[model samples]
Structures are given as structure tokens and as C-alpha cells.
Target: SEQTNKHLYLFEVLVKNIDINRNLLNDYEKDLVIKNPIRVRIIFSDFYDVEIDEVKDCKSIHLPEPEQVKCHSKMSRTATKEKNGKEKPKQPKQKQKVPEEMMYVKKTSLHSQKAGFSCLFPMEPMEMLEKLKTSSLYFLIFSNMGEDEAKKIIGQAKVDVRKNFIDSVQYASATGEFPTTANLTTSCKIENVFKEVSGRIEVYVRLSCFGKFIMSMFNMLYNERNPANKKTDEEEKKAETTS
Candidate 1:
């Protein structure tokens, strides 16, 4: 059965955090301290040939303010300044925390048509694996929605599909123990699976297979609705009978 041979790849992308650089904001925005609601737009590219009919290409989500933390760098610089005309020795570099106003956090799933489920990618398992190697996801952050609903871009980030996803699946296929889940943390620098504009993004990914019986039923209904598919199926059935 063709349906039995095909595999459905389901992907769920949960965006966790976005930390924008303070320098990226203009003088007016910096003083206001990001009071406007933050919005994120997500796009998955170079992956599935066909997305679910209900899945939207540009999925947007609103983010709440992240937990605040004092800026360590600013404090350190101030503390280390010359006192009594004596220069203070440089100390070890301290990890800088993103300012509260510049950080946004929202645990929302992207590309999902339902509460917990995302769009299904119907294809051969091998083909899906190959495609996953080159797939990518893009994130666009926006703030300050105007009266016309036009969003101002703050920054952008890109993530590669192969990081924790494809490698785990490949290992599972070889070892026959598929975990069907992976986690990725984006960095401040723009690289594979990293964030850009000095921001961070964390994502939890889930993958699952669709049942064969359900796929068969879907195909049957689709063939019934489309004359081309119906004609092809009938011709195949006739050929099978003659053979």
C-alpha cells in the first residue's frame, strides 16, 4: 500500500525566550524601555513540500516581559572606574544578563494548527530525513504596533533544522530506539541554530509519525474529491486486475 510506505512527519516548535540587545533600540525606544507589546513571527522554510491546509505560513505570537535582572556589565564598569586618581585593576569578565525591558519570554508553540499538534508533512521517511538536513527556521521580532497594525522590526534570528533534530533521528534509526524529541538553545551570535542581533531563543521540538490507517483514510477521501487522483487510482486498480 502506498499509504503504508509513506511517513508523516509532525513537528512542534515551542519558542521560549527572546533577548534583544539594548543597542538595537533607538534613543526614543531605549528611554521608553520596551513598553509596547512584543510580537514574534516564525517561518519554517526548505522543509516540507506541502503543509497542512490549515497551517499558516506566517505565525505570530505575543510575548510577555521576561524576568528582570540588573545589568552586571554596567555595574562592573562603574565599580572599576578610577578612584582617588588610581586606576583599578581589571577583573575577570562577568557574564552579562540581559536587561528586563530588553528580554521577552513566552512559551508558545509555532506552526501548530491545534493546541498541541503541528502541521503534518506527508512523505517517504527517507525523503523526510534528507530534507530535514537542509531545513531552516526564521524568527522575526517586532514591537510597537501602530494604528494601522504595522509592526516595527526589532531583530531577527535563524535556526538550522539539523542540530538536535536530524542527528537524533539518524542515531535512532541506526540503533532502533527513536526518542522522537529534541531541544535546541539559540545563541546570541548568528550561526547554525543560533539567534541574531545579540538575542537568545530556546525551543523544544517534537516529532511523531501518523498512523497508516488514518493516512489511508485521508488519501481515500482526497482521491474521491479530486478527479485526477480518482482517475489515477481507477487506472491502477484496472491494471492490477488485468495483471
Candidate 2:
């Protein structure tokens, strides 16, 4: 049966060696880590609204070849430039508007080799839960250990989850103000480091946060770069030429 209107959380883990030139590591350091390290990316997402289940059998999933994380925002900025000797007119920049409400998770101290890291979700419990139900969160764990070594270490690691009700009605009695937000944090760590792999390895981690919510609504197709839009524009140009 297809799953819909359901709340789901799945963690996607990837393991790969770090690229010396691409990563922030020196030649000697890169050489050391290359023999003993694995880069990891943990992608978390809410599959409640997805039509197809992405992670049906996630437990025994195999890691694919490593891929570099591109900065989409930067790519968008660069793609708007002129091409084919065509110069686009510059329009006046509009003032950016600030949003009324915002939520985020803050990491106090995060590292690759370390299994346990702290995450702080700054928002009300209900609000944060809603966000989780509608958004996808990513955690990048970089390691200086080889893929095999890193996997073994991660297999024995422990993850601890805790919730802190910062802003609550009862707590307001002592603090004189009602708490409006809650902090949800999790600590993860890999214990029992293997001795086979040595040297100071560095891991680069990236987290992707996506907000996708569906409340009684269906899918939305963005036409910004759709071929239909382009076809219409071309048709209009042809008509103009004929007229």
C-alpha cells in the first residue's frame, strides 16, 4: 500500500575518501587521511508527502561513489549571467524582506571522528515537530579513517536523543516568562577506535535542510525552466515575426 499522510524519518549515510585538493587539508595531511579516512553524509528527510518511497530498505543500503556537494545558491547566481554574446539588462534590486518566523538547529561542537555531536532545535516542540514532519534535514560527518575502518567504528557508535522544554507555562512561574520554544538535541559518538588506521584524519560534513509540506494540497510543478514555458515564448516570437 502507498503511504500518504504519514510522518517518516530516514537517515541516508554515505562513505567516501576525502579529496585533498577539494578539501581543506594539506598535502601531508591529505596523504595521511587518504589511507585512513572516509567522508560521511547523513541525509534525513520526511517521506510523508513523497509519491515514491526512497528508502524502503535502508538498513542494508550500500553507499554509492562519493560526489561533491555543490552550492546551488552560488550556481543560481552565476547562471543568471549573459551567454552567447547576449547582454541582459540589469534591473534595480529590490529590498529583501525578512520572514516573520524562522527555525533552525544549531550545532555546538561537531567533528567527524567523534560519534556524538550536539544539535539544538530552536523552536517550540510542536513547531519543531511540524517542521520535521514537513522538512528534510541533513547531517554531514567527515572522517579521516578509511571506509572500512570508519564503518566499523560507526557500527559500534551510540546515538542519544534528548528534549529540553525551555519555554513552558509551569516554568514561567520561576522564570517570570512563559517559554515559547523548545530545544531538541541529539548526541552521537563512535567508540572503540581501531588501531589499524592511524594519523590525524579530517572529515568534511554538509547538512541539507529542506522544507516540503503538504496540507490537503497535492503536487506543484514549477514552470520556471519548464520546456512548456520555453515553447510558448518561442511561439510568441514566431507570431511577432509573421505579423
Candidate 3:
């Protein structure tokens, strides 16, 4: 399947007080490393705003599948036969990597001494839209900060009608066009706040314009099949009204 440069939608996500352990020494007293842990949950749905019940009870969303992946041959073809009429030994075939749904989380800015987060979905619109519906998306209780910091943030943040108001700085990264602002409404919470935390934690949620994706796909297919149907600026208006 052919792909275009246009992104399905853009998201702006950020985390604060991300540097949890500012002054921790290693076991050998050689280097400072992050020892405290953070946990995050991301939720996606068709509602304009998600609810606390939704995030906690919802199952992980299914990602789209590849349309036309090319499987490569590991070894080059050998000659039909050797001079003595025996086939030459061929190199062993290598395994191909299976494609998986992946998202990248990048730190975009440093707040005071804290760091902010960014995430991107780098797949095509067709594959991306297959499993998605239009509307609300939520990144819940996500933190680059430590467990204590994550707890504080989630606690201070206010939520009304299944929405959380993020008073701290956060926004979506720029896409091909301008990035849209997130309407602060939806349920969000850090997973396992009471339990001990450990390891690298990152989360992402995206709300895409499914209607636009449908229109774009229709236009692309229609234009490709009937190139002659394309009209000039003047004729386009006439065709629109007549059709």
C-alpha cells in the first residue's frame, strides 16, 4: 500500500519533575542513576472524554495490521549446477523481523529541573485508522517523575465528570501541520500508586480524526483510478454543484 506524508493526527504529551533521583550514588559510588520507579497508563476511546471507570476497566486497544509487507529472501540464488553437475551449497536463510506496533516517547523540554515527554506514532493512516474510532484519547497518570512525584501530580490535579485538569505545562508535538490543543477532559490515573514502583515507564494515547482518514482514503483511491476526473479550480466548483 502506498503511503503519504500526512499524519493521521498529532498528540502533545508531557511529564513534570521527571528527574526523580538528583543525588543518588551507585553501589560502587561511581555514578548517579535513577532508582525510584514510575508507572503509567494510556487509554483510547470514542467518547469526547473518558471516565475513571473506563481507564481502569478497559482492555488494551488492538493495533492495526500491516497491509503489504514485503518478505525478503535471506540468501542469493545459487547457480543451477556446478561444473560437475552437482548443485552448489547455498547460504543459510536469515529470519525476518516481525513488525510490531511501536511508539516513541521523547523528552522535549526541561521544566525547572524536571523534564517533559513526547510521543509519536509513525505508522501509515490506513493501518492506524483500521482499529481506531473518532474522538477522545487519554494519557493517564503518566510520569517521568518518580513514584512520589507521580502521586503528588495525580493528587493535585482536579477531575470533573471523568476529566482531569492538568495545571502543569503540557502540549502535543508539531505534526506536518500545526498541532491541535487537547481539551482537558477525561479520566486519568497512575497505575499501582500504593504498590512499589520500578523500571522505565512510558505511556501514549492518541485521538485521531477518523472521518478525515476516510475522506483522504476515498479521495486518493478515486483520484488514482480516474485521473481524468480531476478538474481545474474553475471546473471543480461547477462539478461540485452539478454532482
Q: Pick the candidate with the highest TM-score.
A: 1
Worst 10 residues of 3 by lDDT: 50-59
CA lDDT of each prediction against the hidden true structure: 0.48, 0.29, 0.30
Ranking by TM-score: 1, 3, 2
What lDDT tens digits, residue by residue, belong to model 2 across residues 1-243? 011222122221222221222244446545553344333334333321111111211222222221322211011111234777676655424322222221111111222222212122222224434444444433333333434543312222222211222123123223322223322333333222342212222223222211122211121232344668547656876988999
- The sequence of per-residue lDDT tens digits that candidate 3 reaches over residues 42-104 is 344431222111111112211121121112111234445778999876543443332222212
Worst 10 contiguous positions by lDDT, candidate 2: 69-78
Error of 3 at 172 (Å): 18
Q: Which residue window of length 10 is worst by lDDT in model 1?
A: 49-58
Candidate 1, lDDT over the whole model: 0.48
Best-fitting candidate, measured by lDDT?
1
Put the candidates in lDDT order, highest first: 1, 3, 2
User: Between candidates 1 and 2, which one is better according to lDDT?
Assistant: 1
Q: How close is candidate 1 to the true structure, as a TM-score?
A: 0.51
Query: What stretches of model 3 exceed 4 Å from their correct place?
Result: 1-12, 16-39, 46-218, 222-243
Give RMSD to native, each candidate. 16.1, 18.9, 15.9
Better of 1 and 3 by TM-score: 1
